[model samples]
Target: MEKLNWIAVDWGTSHLRVWLMDDQSKVLQHLASDRGMSSLKPEEYEATLIEMVGDALPDQGSIPVICCGMAGSRQGWAEAPYGKAPCTPPSIDAATRVSTKVSRISVFILPGIKQLPAADVMRGEETQIAGFLAENSDFDGVICLPGTHCKWVHISAGEVVSFRTFMTGELFALICGSSVLRHSVDDEGWDAEAFDAAVSDAISRPAAIAGNLFSIRAESLLSGLSAAAARSRISGLLIGIELAAARPYWLGQDVVIVGESGIASAYEVGLIQQGAMARRVTAENMTLNGLRAAHAKMVEIAQ
Candidate 1:
């Protein structure tokens, strides 16, 4: 087995991912579990982490554990607190150390960034941005991270100058699963044409979204609209409204969508419709890179 030097963790509300790394920061092993911050208490965090990677720990010395995401939230292992925006992602100096009963590990949780004036906060996405800027140091534009809560961040001089969050993904879930449109949407087929038309409609008149959403169901029952088209349209309507609000961030700016999900692809399509060019990068790669960047900063601090 490759020698384990340290560990990297991404602990979110819904998932826990760990990477056993060598001295060179290469991943030696990858492990994950559904045990997340939402499920674990303060004391349980250490035990939960040990349960996930105890067997992989080195024998002679304590291994440094660098973590990002919700694990550092106020209710997480230990509150790493929020670093204000216009600053870089937290380095080792800003990390909150959680003393553990396990002598073999020293855990550090990196702080997330907060946009106070906008009342916006992000946990895991900050690290992704750090990792992104680590690679593309010259990049000066916006990064759109589409998920349950999408973030549109503006990067300037390698710092997160400002940002905005949109709950478009969460709204889609609630509307499609529990709202009157539930019957019109399904998990099958895709209609790019329908999606494009809905996006155009929503962009041109974002204020009509509520009425347009009901139209999906109305048209389905009256005109026999396909469930697939309805699903696509639901997604399009939500994203289109989001784009309308986030226009200042992406207008004539280089946009990069960091995610592997279908929603990421939808964002790319939505942006293209508005005459914006976008590049796609896998979320996992950006995350691991972010972890790697955090580790590098930690090393520099120790030296």
Candidate 2:
């Protein structure tokens, strides 16, 4: 086994992932479980972490553990506080130490970013943004993170100028499950042409969205719309509305989609159709890169 130098963690709502890292920033071992922020109490964090990553640590000296995501939320192990926008990705001096009883480990959770006056906040994504910046020091424009709650972040001069979150993913889940549109969609399928058309329609006729949404079910029952087309349409419509709202961020600007999932591909397609330059990156790469960057910073004053 490779010698472990430190630990990198991404503890989200439903999963806890820990990567034992060597000095070269390479993962020595990855340990994951379902004990996420939502399932554990505040005090159980340290013990749980040790139970998962303890064997990777040295026999004597303590090692640093750099973490990001919901583990720093209010209900998490410890609140790391949100660093407002117009500032760099909260990884520089934003890490909060978790009081650990284990003498062999020290835990630090990175702070998130908040946009004032608009009531928006992000915990884990900021680290990913930081990692992107680390790779593209001069990149400016939009970075779209597609997930349960999608985030469109505007980056300039290595800072999060502003951002907006859309409920596209969650809404799609609900709509596909039991919404009036459920009868129109299937569990899994896609129609690239239909999707692109729906997206185009949504962007071109933003106001027609409310009425257009109902047309899915109506068309399914009347004109016999295929389940695959229905699924794609639903996805397209929601993502289309998101594009319309986030037009200011991506219009004539380079976009970086930091996820390799199907939704990420859909976002890339939708943006390309809108004449935007969008690129792709794996979620694991960005998250781990962000954690690696955070660990470098944490080493500055790591106790």
Candidate 3:
């Protein structure tokens, strides 16, 4: 068996994923940990990383590590600078590295890209963009990455022109779990029709979203709308507002939604309502794939 050459890690705010890859770029083992950046102290990063990948590391004192996500943020172990937006794959590939305590390991921390005009910044999506580039080298269009802060990235000629971040998932969590709507909505299950209606209403009158959100409780209290449906309505309003903002960028371009099933569904519904043809792509291992791609590119450039 070939020896391991590098370790690819996607250490985000809430989860840590480590992959052991052989010289041929095949993953030998994949490990996950809940010790994400949000939960660990700055000093604990090294120990956590070592604990996750120490067993599979080689003794040559030369394993190149590549990582993305919040692990490179201001609160992360080491800060990775942000690359300005309107960047290409090569620009992203040219991201700088952050050093670690491990003498045998060299860590390359990818920089997040920001669009100054829009005040939008992303720490990890750049790596996923690299992964998308790796898979569809010739494609140029809009890619929607749905998550806690869903991002809509615009790519053309291999460059990320601009992107927007929507606080859809975070807002949903806050409203459903902590806000007044929590009492009206079910924690599980979705009402497709109500959700669709809310999306439509929000899209038609985007400015009214704020007022509409407050009305969720009122409708549930006075009009007898089910809590589940109200929850779905709030989700639609937030997602619809996002879609309304993102409509201009995706107006005539092909759209691809990357992320889990539920969020992808919401994005698809919103896009379809706005007359865009959006396709969903499961990004189950995109972080690992992205880290591997970054590592390989670094090795190529170094040679």
Candidate 4:
């Protein structure tokens, strides 16, 4: 096997994570930066990247860099294109890389995935899905990535056939932070009963959710529903709707929820209520693994 050192990056809207690997692809060191896509301009991207990886750069020709996440979006350093749905391992490998300079080092940005007219898009999660597939190559089913903007992906025969994006987390944040419900709820603490009740209400009468949202404030004014309870209600309602939308795809399929423990638990609860079997998998390192897989493929092609 040809020997090469690699730098892996998973840069998102609010944070940047970098990893250094030797020829065998074992991680040597990792670094993080707050200079994420949301805060940096195009011209400053190179300087920001070099600042994070400068000390780790190998003396050889530019270390091959593989990256995933919002770093490839329109607001990112370079506007890397999106790979449409029905993507397979080979199709992901066929994605074009974005080249940029960081002093003497060359950088390559991976393209995000998109399926148009449906208003669905993904940046960082695609790589994580790739990594998940790499490790569990035999599994074929539906993968649910829960986050600020959750993703529901269908994988079969080593390809991602179709996926959808849900704004569950974002909506939760909006309702909790800016809406009238904010005044009624506390951010800390989880109410299982309230959450379950809201999920049941939503699944049973999803159309009633919109009207009930106003009741959070109305009840607070009339019957005095606790602020925290109102907040949890809103969360349950949004997540419930997400589950309803995703039900069609997940029906009769094995479901894996890729996210941290807390969020995964919430999704699992919702899924269970809807008669779906769901499992939670840790995703902290999935992005790095996926980037490494992509970098390995690039090396093979170069050879």
Best by lDDT: 1
Q: In angstroms, how far off is 91's CA in candidate 4?
A: 7.3
Error of 4 at 264 (Å): 1.6
lDDT by residue (77-108, candidate 4, tens digit) is 78778887777633236554555655446577
Off by over 4 Å in 3: 1-3, 89-93, 222-224
Off by over 4 Å in 2: 300-303
lDDT of 1 by residue, 93-199 (tens): 88888889989999999899998787999999999998888899999999999998999999989899999999998899999899989988888899999999999
Question: What TM-score does candidate 4 get on C-alpha atoms?
Answer: 0.90
| Lowest-sum lDDT 10-residue window in model 4 | 89-98
Least lDDT summed over 10 consecutive residues: which range in candidate 1? Answer: 88-97
Q: Candidate 2 lDDT, tens digit per residue, 200-288? A: 99988888977888998999999999999999988898899999999998998888999757989999999999888899988878989
Which segments of candidate 4 are over 4 A away from where they belong? 1-4, 89-99, 116-119, 222-224
Stronger candidate by lDDT (2 vs 3): 2
Residue runs of model 1 more than 4 Å from their true location after superposition:
none
User: Local error of candidate 1 at 93, Å?
Assistant: 1.9
Model 3 misses residue 222 by how many Å?
4.1
Each prediction's whole-model lDDT (CA)? 0.92, 0.89, 0.82, 0.81
Q: Candidate 2, overall lDDT?
A: 0.89
Candidate 3, 103: how far from true, in Å? Answer: 2.4
- lDDT preference between candidates 3 and 4, better one: 3
Q: Model 2: C-alpha RMSD to truth? A: 2.0
Ranking by lDDT: 1, 2, 3, 4
